[model samples]
Target: MDTLLANITYAGGAVYIFYILTAIWIIAKKNLKLLSIIFPILALLEGLFIDWRWGRIQDYGENAQIVLGALPSFIISIGLPFIGFYIHHFITQNLPKDPMIDSLIEKSKSGAFGNDDYPSIYSLLESKIFEKSSYQKAIQNVENQKELINKMIAVLTDKKDDWDWKFNMFNEYKVVFTLYGTGGSYDPDNGTITLLTNKSGGFMNYKNPANTIIHEITHMGMEYSLVRKYNLPHGLKERLVDTLVYLMFKEDLPDYRIQQMGDPKINDDLKSANDLESLNSIVSKFVNK
Candidate 1:
């Protein structure tokens, strides 16, 4: 019985040490400072209790020398927690920082996506407050989009679809085809459409461009329905809009191929969109009035 108890106690001590060391390593690698600090203190308590349990069990079988065997356990219990804390501090202070993550954290902390703050999609579209300067390039985009809009309106006008859709003023948009992360937001509350793109190279092919217009336009159309049917949170509503846009636009692209990859080239990188064949395939089947 005594031997069994000694073996169990020794195993427990080994496990505790393993957990402590693993936590310390993660603290160093992931730079989880708070977790690192807290875990070490818990580890120390665990170590002390384990040693105490082992000492009590061992006293019954063998007179283990106090200074050589027991003193090391006590020292580790007292010192290891502080060592973990300091290691965490050093890791946090010395770790290389990512500016993008920092920016996101800052934005999150400041309530950047709050209801009262963001601009409406219509307003953003009208203002053309994009980070671009060339009016000619933007005007070309508008002209190309106008043709697509006309085609979509024609398609829908003939079909007796359930939804009432129209261009009231041309606020259609697509996410920036760039590497930056701004393309995927749809705010239901403010009716804002935030797109991220780097449009330096050139606009997407006109044949497929119309699909992009139809995509965003579809989102706008759905927002009206969602606004009437559900009082969803702003972020969730935005995501819903993105999903709907992607689904519809996938039918409008030239080859019926969807671009699943991402790019850092701003508006130049066209995301996966529906091809013309798919749109024609789906729309032709719809019975008209």
Candidate 2:
């Protein structure tokens, strides 16, 4: 314990690990020039804060000072992610224009969903992929909602009328209707929203795919950037998304409701539309604790 505590590298790797991950994030975000400049300043401030805190440690218990030093590191931690998410609100992203909404919300007739790639839990329960009639009918029903769904998505987006360009880390978003899955899923890596067109909508208040599309779109908007980052419980993730959706779109989709899936505890942070705006930082606070 003493050896580890004595070595800053041993006990304070968070700031360093933060540096590497942040560099990757800045590079991936492709705003190297601006973010790179700010990062150095933030890093310098963090270093000074840590140094000052470390120096103030009592002669007998250096660990006390070390922990104090670590406290300010969180400032930089908070600063950078806030910058990233804030940029999303102001920047004009590369999402599809209207009329191109079809391109964003199109149909998938292919029965070969590479079901093996996903877990058995995500696979369809009652219907098979080869159910051509079900698949096509599902596709048409989903497409019919594309126009209204596109509008409802505005509230889920960064701007009133714009789509979340980097939502789920994918630039372009599309929905895939298949007879295989139970309800719906949004894949962040590929920007694909998969919805089960099966007649048997098993759970999560999934009466139909139209509302389910909005739900998954909500998930796509938040999944990686917020939910997974905090290692949030699945139930909490669903609840937060459901709350955001209900707060933003319950009137448009009258049947919309927050299913009893997520941790009711998270409700403390997500009661209104105002809370939705600061969701990233709010969730970020979880790890700070």
Winner by lDDT: 2
- Tens-digit lDDT string for candidate 2 (1-289): 1111221221223443344345434434557467847775755654454444345333333111111101212223323443544365332222112332122122111223233422321222112212334344445555456556656654444442233223442323445443332345555543445554443422334555557767776786677677777787776787877887788877888888887886576678777776666677766665476
Q: For each candidate, C-alpha RMSD in Å?
A: 28.7, 23.9
Q: Which candidate is the best by TM-score?
A: 2
Residue 103 of candidate 2: its Cα lDDT?
20
Off by over 4 Å in 1: 1-132, 157-181, 184-195, 199-208, 227-251, 255-289
Evaluated against the true structure, the overall lDDT of model 2 is 0.48
Model 1 agreement with the true structure over 27-121: per-residue lDDT tens digits: 34454565547555664564455445444332322211111011112112222333554455332111112343234334545546233322332
